[model samples]
Target: MASVKVMRMKLGSEGLDVSAQGLGCMSLTPYYDQPKPEPDRIALIHVAADLGVTYLDTSDIYDNHTNEMLIGKALKGGVRQKVEVATKFGVSFENGREVQGDPAYVRAACEASLKRLDIDCIDLYYQHRIDPRVPIEVTMGELKKLIEEGKIKYIGLCEASASTIRKAHAVHPITAVQLEWSLWARDGEAEIIPTCRELGIGIVAYSPLGRGFLSAGSKFSENPYEDYSVLSLPRFQPENSPDLVTAFKRVSRITQAKGCTPLQLALAWVHHQGNDVCLIPGTTQIENLIENIGALSVKLTPEEMVKLESIASADNVKCSRYISSRATGESSCTPPPSSWKAALKRIFFYG
Candidate 1:
């Protein structure tokens, strides 16, 4: 394998520079499944840092905080300074519900993440999801306080709508907006992504490979509880799986011709978006990590980019527990939520 030299990306004009690509560390610990042995996972992080992949992403809600701890353990042996650690707060997966953006909890969550991470100051901290019930200004206010206290170096938001990203940027210069952007998921492009670009904020695309659908030589499973499962996301339900296959075929034609995997093409497309765009693809195996790093080498032609973009829309990901439970003999996927405010409250607060 050749030495990987990744480009650098600036998170807007905020001066938060990260590797042009990142390693999403969520899969190394849990949530994706039972993690690989601790030493193996730690070795993967070391390898990634050695390969010039520095931007690391995690969230407090991932695997009950074990994800951050794993990174903390890996970075202890003089590897901490080599990587930029970015973790998220504001959403509690405790007992499966609770969107916490209250000022007090924000403070508490930051403290907890810092402790678990064993790091003095986080390179980037993000609000996992906005609590629509709470005003964006209020949450931004808390984040601003953390910055002033020198607990976090940069601030970001995830899964935020375009209007919400703009409003949040008003309170503080959001270094980046973390959202899922891949050939299969282009919701951000319609509004959220452009909003970030317009404001000069950077975009950190998570799940850049379309939740494993674009990965080469890897079997994808649609069941969340099964082995190979990637589900837990409403997008991977049975009804949506076929379209994922079709989308894969569309991209494979180009990858196969280029001697690259669909995953590499998907990642290169994200990079081709602009210097402001970065991708964080997660995996538990070192081979896949190297494969992800190899994506940086696959430069696409203008025609290739156009082809990928033309077939990028792989059906909208819209399914609710309400719809699923209502399905008697067969299941149906609906269009993206038109007015999800009410449904949002029901989901985060009730269920």
Candidate 2:
């Protein structure tokens, strides 16, 4: 019912057209903190659909697969086809934490997700995290088999490095790679962006708003959610305060000049990057979802872009988006080596 700009893109060359601005479904259910009521969560998704958001991002690991079941329940009847469903697998939850990737484990995970989703074919299936024990080739090999069996329409990877992305793409065309890319956290630009661009893989920029730091209400003392705050992590701490808000301030100045909210400006920057890039900023509050949806309407200019990059670069915000040695299974092959110990000291303290 609400009027907003809509951009459609092909899932790789799969011929499937999905909304340029997708909804990140994880926040509505859990993984950020306390879980919302299931019925209320489903209704929120339907609310998003009515708002013109057509691509949804979810994962099997979130709430231990409760997220997918929430999605399936929300999109009952003909609502399923109203949006493009994207979910990830691979992370194993044994003792209340993420375990390494295993090829056999991934296969079973996919089947289980399929059963829970109640869909014969997944719109986009991703390896939630890369398994060091199982080479990309082997994991991709299994994913390729799923594609052959018509279990998944497109294959994707999350938090994968450039080389890993390429190797997986070589085995089977990777339609998309989901990663945390925002003004505050931008490790992806180092190598992942070029690799994805060269390979023609779509970039799903999750947390494009810097996890709400760009929003007008965000502040050092304020938590984005009751229990969730990207800044609450060890990286976005007060120690790295200067770098933490530098990019947001730059965006603020630019957006104020354009007569738009900083949140709109941040989302607009992501939208303006290129056709290949899509942003998925999630929130449970309906008002916030509407505010995020309005980002599609804000447009950035080349001059503003230059200023933003300049200010962001000046700050040199040092922080690992994930907790130390935590992002092990998916983004990197091994744990953070001792060489990173120096960089760790420069990290912003949150939580």
Cα lDDT for residue 109, candidate 2 = 85
Return the lDDT, model 2, position 332. Answer: 20
lDDT of 2: 0.73
State the lDDT of candidate 2 residue by residue for 1-351, as single tens digits.
447756678756556577888898877665556766777778778888877788988888666677888888887878887888888886665755454456677678888888888888898998877777778998888888888899888998888889999999999899998888776667788799889988888889987877666674346435333433444344555466555555556666777778878888878888888888888988887778888888887877798776666665624555456546444523221223542443333221110
For each candidate in the order shown, give its overall lDDT on alpha carbons: 0.78, 0.73
Against the true structure, what is every candidate's RMSD? 5.3, 5.3
- TM-score attained by model 2: 0.86
**TM-score of each prediction:** 0.86, 0.86
The pairs that clash in candidate 1 are none
